[model samples]
Structures are given as structure tokens and as C-alpha cells.
Target: MFAVWGLIVLAGIFVVIRFTGLIDHMLPAGDPPNFTFAPETPVPQARNFFIACPPGRSPRTDRAMPSPSFDATAATLADVMIETAPAHGMQLMSGVPGGKPGRLYFLARTPVFHFPDWVEVEFILPEQGGDITFCLFAQSVYGLDDIQQNEKRTRAWLADIVGRMGPSG
Candidate 1:
């Protein structure tokens, strides 16, 4: 039937797009700093994103540790993120404010469909000199529902980071 043939052609086109990396061009890599990580409403209502805020701020507590300075903590975070991302099918796209000690953005692709997702992480250092904290926001670029994929990926990354960072405060 014509409908079946059309479907086959469309599927082939999608496969080509995925293989050729054209999907990256089609999906927008949103502004990292613009992502909201507020405690009251960390994630959007669409169930396509997950946000982990600092302790005492959100329902999910982020990993934190005592550090002598922000630079040291940022370096540690960057190393851990770089090591862990590839394991989860992610690659660092860019960083806000030039580089770390600020926000980092990553592009992740789903295993099956190769759907694109953007993850933004911001390192925070309290003025009072307490523990260093970071907030992470991950969202799908082309879906209204990700079936909790963002949450699972966020949790897995956090666990890996925590393991690499050793005991947290």
C-alpha cells in the first residue's frame, strides 16, 4: 500500500538523519544559565525534565562537599563530569561563562531513538563559605514526555559523580 511505502521511506529518512548527526542541528541547545533550578518548582510540569537542587532547597538533595575554594571544587566537578558523561551517551557541548566555575552544558542521546537532550549543571559556592553545591537540569529537546528518562539519567550521573568524589558532606 502507499501508506506502508510512505512509512518505510520516512523511517529510512529518520535513520539517515540519526546516523549523519543532522538531528543535532535540528534540536536547539538551550541557554544553560536560563534553566530554572528553584527549590519550589525545580522541574517543568511536562515530565520531560529533571532538576536536582542544593540541599534544604529542593525535594531531591544534590551532592555537596566542603572545599577550600570554588576553583578546586569546580575542577573536581569538571573532571568527574567529563569522565562520566561518555558512559551515559553524552558529550560536552560547551560551558557558560567561558568554562567551569560556572555552568556546563552537555548533549545526550537516547539509546534507542537517538533523541536529543540537553543537560545543564551549575556549580554554586555559598558566600558564607559552607559546602559547595551544584544544580543539574536535564530536559528532552523534542518530546512532551520522556518517560522519566531524564530523571534516571540525572540520578545515574549523580551517583557516579558522588562515587568519584568520595564521601559527601
Candidate 2:
């Protein structure tokens, strides 16, 4: 069973590399402000992504409420996301233009393998003083399937963010 032993060794090596954070260097974080969130044509066909936009902002009309409406301002929501990211194993990525409101990029790694995933969030502030809405797009960097990890992580992060925002939010 040399092949079995060899496989075990390889798996161990990968685990080591992942825990050391060495795999992060090889992953692409993607260009910010370039990713399309929702209501955009030709979304990626990969199954390893999750997109959450407000009710009217997405093409999927079956979803009663795809994303939560925030009572806070975009700036406040951004602040909440920034504060909550690290706790969810995410780090903010650079390259967003300053003075441009409502766009944020983040890099997240899987808990075990450290596979990189890019997350983009766009806050939508209505002109008529309505609740703030947002779109979140999270995609894996090197996989055709992620077993719904992206959706789970996005939902958990959103819940934590809303919890932090309190009753009014």
C-alpha cells in the first residue's frame, strides 16, 4: 500500500502549507471595482459562488428577500463589515478608489485548506431616504464547486453584521 502512504504524505504536506499561509501567494484576489454584482449580464457559471442582492436588484424573483435592508447608512454598514470581517476569517483587500462610496473588496480563506475566496460588497443607498441595500458576491478562486461554503459564510457574516447593528438596523 505504498500509494496509500504516499497519498497520506501528500495530504499532510498540503495541510502544512495551508496552515503556514503559503498558499495565499498563489491565489488571485481579482481586480476591484471590476466585478459585476447583480442585474449584470453573464454571471459566472461556476457553482462555487454566492450572490446576495436586494429583492428587486436580482433576476431571481422567486426569492422573497434575497438580501437584508439596512436601516443604517452605507458608511455605517461599511464600518460594521470592516469590524466583523476579521472575526469571520476575512481581510480587506486593496485597490478600491478612495472617495468612491459603497464598494468594498475582501479576501477570505477556507478554514482548513486555506483556499482563497474573493468577496465584493456594494452598498446601495436610495435617493428617497429608503433603507440601505447591498449586494454581496463571493467566489472561490480555484474551484468549480465549493459545496455551498460561500453561501454559508456569507449568510453567517451577514447575520453577525446585522446583530452588531442592533434593533433599529
Candidate 3:
């Protein structure tokens, strides 16, 4: 029993080292993520990063700075809508189907430095595609006291979005 417990502890340590990117240099190029959820959504194929759940607890918004400014600088309008936003962590990047001409709004929580926490994204795409609106509302927190809460929040938020979208490319 003592030997088994020792082995378990060692295995746990190994897993942590692997997770923190320490063992990456020794591994070969990994196969792309075989996503069970969104088989059609195109994931970046050439990266060697592991998938990690977002930290659930809220960020330290009380000390966080304000949102940053985002600009749409693509030649084509569609390019402006989809491609450009996520590059800047614009959560909901999509085209509008009806109503409204063409409008884009970028939003984020305090401390634009730590983006992806909160955002308000929108754009119009004529009469075919529906308007896209991504509104992320999160806070940044630090220390061990809030870790569990933060992680829970992140997972919940991600699950909600994925649940609604079904899957993506």
C-alpha cells in the first residue's frame, strides 16, 4: 500500500510538470485536437498547446484598468467582422442578417491588459447572416482564496456558450 501511494504521488507530480509546458520540448508534434463538440469548427492546426480549462474565479476588477480601444482595419467588411475581432479577443465576431446598416462595437472589462474576461462585440451583415453580439462579463481575482470561484465562473461561462452554439469552426 505504501508503494502504491508513493507511485500515485509521483504520477501526480509528473502530470503537473507536463501541464506547465516543461515537457513540451521532448515531445513530437502532436495531432490536432480531436474535438468531440464542434467537429466542423476549424481549430488552429499547428499548435502544440494543451487545452486548459479557463480559470473559474473572477479577476481583480476592482484594481483592473479600463477597457482598451479596438479598431477594424480590414479591407473587406466581412474581414473586418470575423477575422479581426478574435485576434483582439472580441468574443462575439459574426455577421448581421437584417436591420441596421453596418456597425461594430468593441467592449471589455477593466484592465484591457487582461482581456477575454469581459467584452461587448457586435457587427451587422446585411440580410443573410444574423447580427453577432458577444458580451463577456468577467472579473479578475488573485490568490488561492478565490481560485475555486474564479475557475468555476470561467468553466460555466464557456460551457454556456458552447452549449448554445452546438459547435463551430
Candidate 4:
């Protein structure tokens, strides 16, 4: 009787996963994406940087790529800090854009409660010729409790970074 019930439940789950299109929608559509993490180099000055984005979103596209833009409303940096600051409110002391395509650097103060009392973010535009290597790091931070609590928050940061992509080249 138990085996029969288990089979029935399994069949139902399979039907929903297959017929409901959930499996197709949830599965990744392309090759695995690469994310890079590099310590800032001199000239650029040594600092921490990570790049994360989904597959098919690389800078190598021949398709007409739209210049990146910042979120006008809640997705703005200020909005993001407002949402993320209490748990890890870091002051954004300075921000500079790279001369190339869309590179950006941010200096932020670490919340009193968190480790590494300072965190810097440097995001380079794919158009400038770079691979996205920071996605793995973002995933790791989301996995670790000491860094970020939820992956969604990390994703928000990624979105904000992507949002900062420039309008030209």
C-alpha cells in the first residue's frame, strides 16, 4: 500500500514538472557562465573585485547591445544601501568610473557588526573585453552566512552593478 502511494505521488510530481513547463523554465538555457574575481592591479591600485552574471549575457554579443543604465527608482545604489545597510550598511565614500567602456569602482564602509570593515566593488563592462568571473564569488557569499544572508540580496547587487552599465560603448 505504501509503495503504491509513493508511486502515485511520484507520478504526480513528474506530471507537474513535465507538463507544467516548470522544468524547462527552471533549467539553464546555455553553456555554464564564468565569473572572475581579481584583486585590483596597480595603476588601477590593488583592490577586491568580483564579476557575476547569467549565461547569454556576456559582452561578446554581436546583437545590438543596449548600453547599461542605472535603476531610476528602488534599484539605485542609494536604494540598495537603504535596504541592505542595517544588516551591513557600508558607507559609499567614493565612486569612480573607468575610462573604458563601463568600469566602475565603489568604496564602502563595512557595517560595525560585519567582518572586513570595508568592501570595495569594481565592475567592468563586458564591452571593454572581459569575462564575468565574479558570479561564483557572489554564489559563495550567498552560501556563507558571514557575508550575505540571502542569494537574492547578492543578486540585487549584481543587478545594481549591471544597472550601472553605461549608455555609450
User: Which prediction has the highest TM-score against the true structure?
Assistant: 2
The whole-model lDDT of each prediction reads 0.70, 0.75, 0.32, 0.34
Comparing 2 and 3 by TM-score, which wins?
2
Clashing pairs in 2: none
Ranking of all candidate structures by their lDDT, best first: 2, 1, 4, 3
lDDT of 4: 0.34
Count backbone clashes in candidate 1.
0
- Better structure of 2 and 4 per lDDT: 2
Q: Which TM-score value belongs to model 4?
A: 0.26
Q: Assess every candidate by TM-score.
A: 0.72, 0.81, 0.21, 0.26
Please identify which of the two predictions, 1 or 4, would achieve the higher lDDT against the true structure. Answer: 1
Candidate 4 lDDT, tens digit per residue, 1-169?
9999999999888788766656544542221112223322111111232233334333232211222334233234334443453443333433323222122222232222122222333333334443322212211211123333223434555455454442223
Which residue pairs collide in model 1, if any?
none
**lDDT by residue (tens digit), candidate 3, 12-73:** 88787666655444432222122221223333232211122112221322312221112222
| Steric collisions counted per model | 0, 0, 21, 10
- What tens digits encode model 2's per-residue C-alpha lDDT throughout 110-167? 8876788888888888778788878887878888988888888898998998788863
| Residue 119 in model 1: lDDT | 82
